[model samples]
Target: MGARRMAKGIGEFLMELVGEAVAEVILGLLACALLLSLGLIAYLSWSFSPRLTVAGAGGLSLFLAYGAWGAFRNPSKDRRRRGVAAVATGGFTLAAATAVFLFFYGSDCGCL
Candidate 1:
């Protein structure tokens, strides 16, 4: 019975994570659409820039970090796993974004 409960909890956690990812994607799409409609995104359609991308990633990491803090505050064993995963993911994303920022910044060439 305990094993079954654990499995169900794990499944729920997975689903919740998936839902969060999907929501983020949808939110990004909406933001992009809004920008395009407002003619902001079109101004640089012919160019490629990672500044916006790094900002997005950094923002996502911050969100995940906040979620991790919430998960850690939960008084449940199952949530500990989720908290660890969130911390790892958030740290990884932040590190990657920082690396990209440093590289581009040192290059002294804003966008390719």
Candidate 2:
């Protein structure tokens, strides 16, 4: 094949790989959000408190679940478009989880 065709082939392959990787990560984030949401719900039901964990985890779960669903389901229609969104969702989830951890277990709060 010509060089241009070869380059196009490589670009297509890379795009496909990126889409698949994003899908996997988005799915994983969805699972994490679901689990965290369930845990927070259990804690709320059992403990009954107005705390950072409840609000943060609950909000994170809601955002991730919906965002991941949109990214996972309609990938083909906008593969390149949604791929970035999937990656962003994962990144945001990680940030939210870290913030939640720091807020709940920070030295100032005395959870440790």
Candidate 3:
């Protein structure tokens, strides 16, 4: 009976470790996706008009950077933080996309 209990305890510990590892990988992937999307936003903005308005571009970039940092610092922190960061990053990205679109379609911002 004692040996069985020990085995069960060890199994539970291993399962927890695996869960944490999976979470870490998922968070890392999220970070990479944010950065990649931000890059694409920047490229599209610049492509429209070498000097187009990048109003929220910098903020969006910073948002992604901060998110990555937060994830790296606290991998095991409540999953809520990760979700919040991702949402913030997405918001910034949307802002950047809007700015780029308005720059090309809206009234001339004299970027070009």
Candidate 4:
């Protein structure tokens, strides 16, 4: 075997995606909620508010990408399916929660 697995062809990747249930978005969202709730409790020890909790939780979630990166880099074929799930869930958490930081104080995304 090569030092790294061969890159997947677009057609094969598409077929794999088509066969998967992509709606595990709900699982990702639940993880975001868990992070937020945990942050809220931790923040309460110092000072707390809904806004800070959301932003802080979102900020903390970027750490999840380490797991995704590791999963992608691992050499085992047996764990590849679980790795796909990890990437999807981690990608959603990183994109939706870390970048979003939403719905506190009737605020917008404030991306600008």
Candidate 5:
């Protein structure tokens, strides 16, 4: 009976960890999708002024950076896993920032 209880406890812990991981993945994807949609809108909207575009992009980037930092700063028993999450979050943040910048400023470049 004691061994069976121990097994059940371990199963529960594993399930909880899986749930947390799934939640994190979903949140990350949602963030990326939102940023992508914003970039598309900014790119396609001719009436939106450059100043407003820059301000909106900067604000969004700052907000996302803060959120990503907060979400990934927690101590985890699996350091490697945490490191991967941090890297993924940082990459997504960078991508979002770059998309916003390009949408607003890429036209200024002569190469385009």
Candidate 6:
């Protein structure tokens, strides 16, 4: 009976650890994707046109602002994780918005 109890406790601990690890891994992937998309958008906009450059920058700035707000709004628990998630969410939104804009507004430079 004691061994069974120990085994159960260990299993619960391992499950909790796995959950946290999974969350961190997901957040990390989001950060990476955000950075990569931002870089790509900047590069494409640099040579495309002033209109696109302005639009992309504006959209990204808005996302950043929203992320900052979210991070500050909930400062009691998991502050670091919340901040990371906010930034990742903002970046993903910006990237998606930029993609949609590019898709419908099709650049004339043929670089897209």
Q: Which candidate is the best by TM-score?
A: 3
Cα-based TM-score, every candidate: 0.36, 0.40, 0.49, 0.24, 0.43, 0.46
Residue lDDT tens for model 5, 1-112: 9999999999999999999999766655555666567667988653568788788878767767765774557656665434555665776668767767555545343332
lDDT tens digits by residue: candidate 6, 1-112 = 9999999999999999999999766655555565567678777878789787898779767776666566456566554545666665677666567566544433332332
lDDT of 1 by residue, 1-112 (tens): 9999999999999999999999766655554454345345534532456677567657867776765555446567554446656666566666556556445443343222
Model 4 RMSD in Å is 16.2
Candidate 4 local Cα displacement, residue 26, angstroms: 26
lDDT of 1: 0.60
Query: What lDDT score is found at residue 9 in candidate 5?
Result: 100
Off by over 4 Å in 2: 48-112
TM-score of 3: 0.49
Show where candidate 1 strays beyond 4 Å.
40-112
Extract clashing residue pairs from model 2: none
Q: What is the lDDT of residue 4 in candidate 6?
A: 100
Lowest summed lDDT across 10 adjacent residues in model 6 is found at: 103-112
User: How much does each candidate deviate from the true structure in C-alpha RMSD?
Assistant: 16.6, 15.7, 15.8, 16.2, 15.0, 13.4
> Clashes per prediction?
0, 0, 0, 0, 0, 0
Which pairs of residues collide in candidate 3? none
Off by over 4 Å in 4: 1-59, 81-112
Candidate 3, lDDT over the whole model = 0.64
Using TM-score as the yardstick, the better of models 3 and 6 is 3
Model 5 residue 102 CA deviation (Å) reads 19
lDDT of 4 at 46: 40
Candidate 3: tens digits of C-alpha lDDT, residues 81-102: 5476777656656666755655
